[model samples]
Target: MISKKYLIVIVGPTAIGKTSKAIEVAQNYNCEILSCDSRQFYKEMSIGTAVPSKEELSAVKHHFIHNKSIGDKYTVGDFERDAIQKLDLLYATSDFAVMVGGSGLYVEAVLFGMDEFPEIDPSIRVEIQNNYQNLGITYLQENLQKLDADQFEVIEKGNPQRLMRALEVCLQTGKPYSSFLTKNTKKRNFIPIIIGLEADRSLIYERINRRVDIMIEDGLLAEVKSLQNFKEINALQTVGYKELFAFLTDEYSWDFAVETIKRNTRRYAKRQLTWFKKNEYTKWFNYNESSKTIFDYIDSKKTETEI
Candidate 1:
């Protein structure tokens, strides 16, 4: 049975104002926040990660933001372990805690312990990375299409990381990566109230474009430049930094790079939505709705159930 103690999770695709809304909830319940944003782990990536605003940080205690160096090799497994530990401490001090982000894998890492895949040889990873560098991400996409046509329909072709991982497993075991998704969900003790914030597709795209512009005004370019020395860092392999890195490396004009950031951000948000929509447990809310309006729906659900 789920614990009666509350663990609120505010989630959605990127730019859905989850951080701000989480702060509001924390203030209301006098609880702390455990961030699940995979990117915000890096101390050096404030603007690019769209981390909590200063005011929001000041409003409530937040754990796991800006706590790791860019070079640190962290994984969802690590996050799951650390978050559970933090939750234990937080639960000791308060009856509730808010966890929030758009990271589907990271969120699942906490709520459901990630299934451990057999460790692939390091050479397998190196081989796949080399192939991606030589033949491009399209090569991996084509491979996935051939291996698992159904998965190819939903997978993003632009993300080399996912493509390479799938390709690596195929090359190593001659099996589709999707086939290895065989683990059952691990039970959790805490009560998770998942709240997803969403908007119309066009509205989400507009918000992403506007957010990219605001990120520019907030010094994303300078932030990227300062981290140029660490361009090869895995943390810097993200969308914003990679786009801006192209400009810094003279591969693209700054204008084109900025446009690419907006375009890629929109695609990322779409992928996030697709990933989150898979879970039947989430209750989605429109960003246009007032907090009271959304909370009323949640309250009604709670009253209808024993929760």
Candidate 2:
């Protein structure tokens, strides 16, 4: 008989030390790490996305970091499929695998699976795309807000692709996009031990500001400059890159752009905290908590579940 496999998921807001904690756990279990952070998947986005350091990567066998290009059309669905396959291969050699990221949607996709929406009409998508091209993101945002305010509250408002998809679903089915999100979750093979690291809101913001400053000092502007021609790509439409792109185009002053990146990163961290807190099963810890405490909690949970 096949032995049961366990997936240890480390989740938290940005700059919260989830990566280091995940590495510690992976080392303890002697297993590989699977990255679920969507932004860190691109090879071109290193400093701004806060991809793990070379030392961290060398400490553990990691999969999915810097595996794709910014130009690739990858989605949460694609990650879910690829992550599960990687987990299956890991479980064949070891029973425990560590998955880490701040991307709540990607984590939930791997844990509970994605919500299924009906096939959209081609014309609906085309119309939304055309309207987005001509009228800009505000048009899509306004439409989604009118159709599904709940989804509007949760989605990345600046991401035209997400806005367009939500608007397409709302228009195609004549119902709120969020209504289709209620389908029963798909089952998975391994049991997940979800862990969350949190800190005071003020500390979280401070860390985000410091991290952004470090990114700028570490040549984030040069990285953004290298990808300036691809600034319009969906992958580059993120907090750090977008703000710096505006600066490069004379749309924002240098100080203003840097401040905007810090402010936006803080907001993103708040959203991440809100998303992770909704999962009651997650055992929350202080950002500075020791790895041994976390390991003890995991072992206790494992014992209880196996009984």
Candidate 3:
């Protein structure tokens, strides 16, 4: 019998040390790193997105990091197709590959296929975007809450793009957006061993706060400033950039913007944990776990499954 290939998924909230662990494991297994972090895909938003450092990128080969221009239109569906193709190619030369990221939806897209939605009128999306731009996220948020309370509760409400997408889906389908979510899992050639890294809530908040400080120290402000012209882009609708952009627009003071970034990131981390926790297949470990311990667990899992 042919041996099964393995896909080691390193998942956790932001700033929980998933990157370093991924590198160490990939180095040991001689496999490549495939990042599923939705923010890291853009080339223009490094500091805010927290792309891996030069030394870490050099330590192991990585894919999907800084691979797209912010001006390009990319979706979770696009990433799902691209990632599967890459994994197919990687499996040609190696039996193991590593994927690490904090984007729960993107990670799920690669694992279980995205739900198929009916092709609605293009004007519906345009109308949603116009409402978001003219009336603000509150308009979309209130609408989504009224239309699909369940999806509104789970989705990242701070993300205008997500809010708008859900609203559009609800209106276009004349049904709750949550109604489209399917529980079916897609079959894949590779077996996934999901590893989750976590810390206590207090510690996780502390790390998030410190990471935001480091991002400011590393010139996240300047990076956001450069992308100010592209603020309308969906990729810039995230935590770090949005808060800083508010500062740039004089919506808040510099210090207040930074504080908001920290607070929003903490919320995002919480949401990430909630999403990953739903996956019972994930084996949880402390964020500071030694790479060897994780490697051994992966080895044991591979043995158990392969036998």
Candidate 4:
């Protein structure tokens, strides 16, 4: 009989050391790492997205990091297809693989499959965009909260793209955008061993603030300046870049932008923990837990499956 393959998924909020943990696990299993962080997929977004360091990338052969240009139209569906294909190839030689990221939606796409939404009219989306441009993101946020408070609670509140998409779906269907997300999940061949790293809320916030400061020191401003022309792109509409772009555009002072980045990052980390904790099967470890402890837990899980 063929032994079952395992996909070890390491997840946590930003700045929680998920990358280092993933590298250690991959080295132990002699397998490659596949990144599910949607922000890390772009070639032009290293400092702001906190793409793995050069040493970290070299320590473990990583897939999907810096694999696409900001100009590319990649979606969760594309990542799910690409990641599964890569996992299939990896499993041909090894019984284990690692996937690590903070992007919960993308991780869900790879694990259970993307949620199916009804086809929405293009005109509704266009109308929403026009209103967003004229009335701003506040309009979208208020409407989504009114239409679907459940979705409003979970979504990245600062993401205009997600906000607009949800709003358009709600308008087009005369129903909450989240109602369509209840479809049955798709099955996969490999069993998933999910490990989550966490810390006290105060500690997580401190780390996020320190990391943002380090990004600035690492020339995040220069990186954002280089991508200023593409500021309107969906990928650039994220936290760090968006705040800095506002500074560049004279909409915010430099000090205010930096502070906003830290504040927004803390909020993003909170949302990440909320999303990952919903999975009852996730084996969570403290942020400072030793790798040996985690490895032993993973081994025990694998053994149980075999038995």
lDDT of 4 by residue, 16-85 (tens): 9999999999999999999999999999999999999899999999999999999999988899999999
Each prediction's RMSD to truth: 2.3, 1.4, 1.5, 1.1
Candidate 1 Cα outliers beyond 4 Å, as residue runs: 1-3, 148-159, 300-307
Predicted candidate 3 versus true structure: per-residue lDDT over 114-205, tens digit per residue: 88877868999999888888998799889999999877766888998888788888999889987876466789899999999999999999
lDDT of each: 0.83, 0.91, 0.92, 0.93
Clash pairs for candidate 2:
none
- TM for every model, in the order presented, reads 0.91, 0.96, 0.95, 0.98
lDDT of 4: 0.93
Ranking the candidates on lDDT from highest down gives 4, 3, 2, 1
Model 2 alpha-carbon drift over 4 Å, by segment: none
Sort every candidate by TM-score, greatest first.
4, 2, 3, 1
Candidate 2 per-residue lDDT, tens place, 1-307, comes to 5578899999999999999999999999899999989999999999999999999999998999999999999988899899988988888889899999998889998998888778998998899999999999889999899999977877777778888888999998999987776356888889999999999999989999999999999999999999999998999988899999999989999999999999988878877887788789999999999889999999998788787
Give the deviation of candidate 3 from the true structure as CA RMSD. 1.5
Between candidates 2 and 4, the one scoring higher on TM-score is 4
Shift of residue 242 alpha carbon in model 1, Å: 0.7
Steric clash pairs (candidate 1): none
TM-score of 2: 0.96
How does model 1 score by TM-score? 0.91
* lDDT of candidate 1 at residue 215, scale 0 to 100: 95
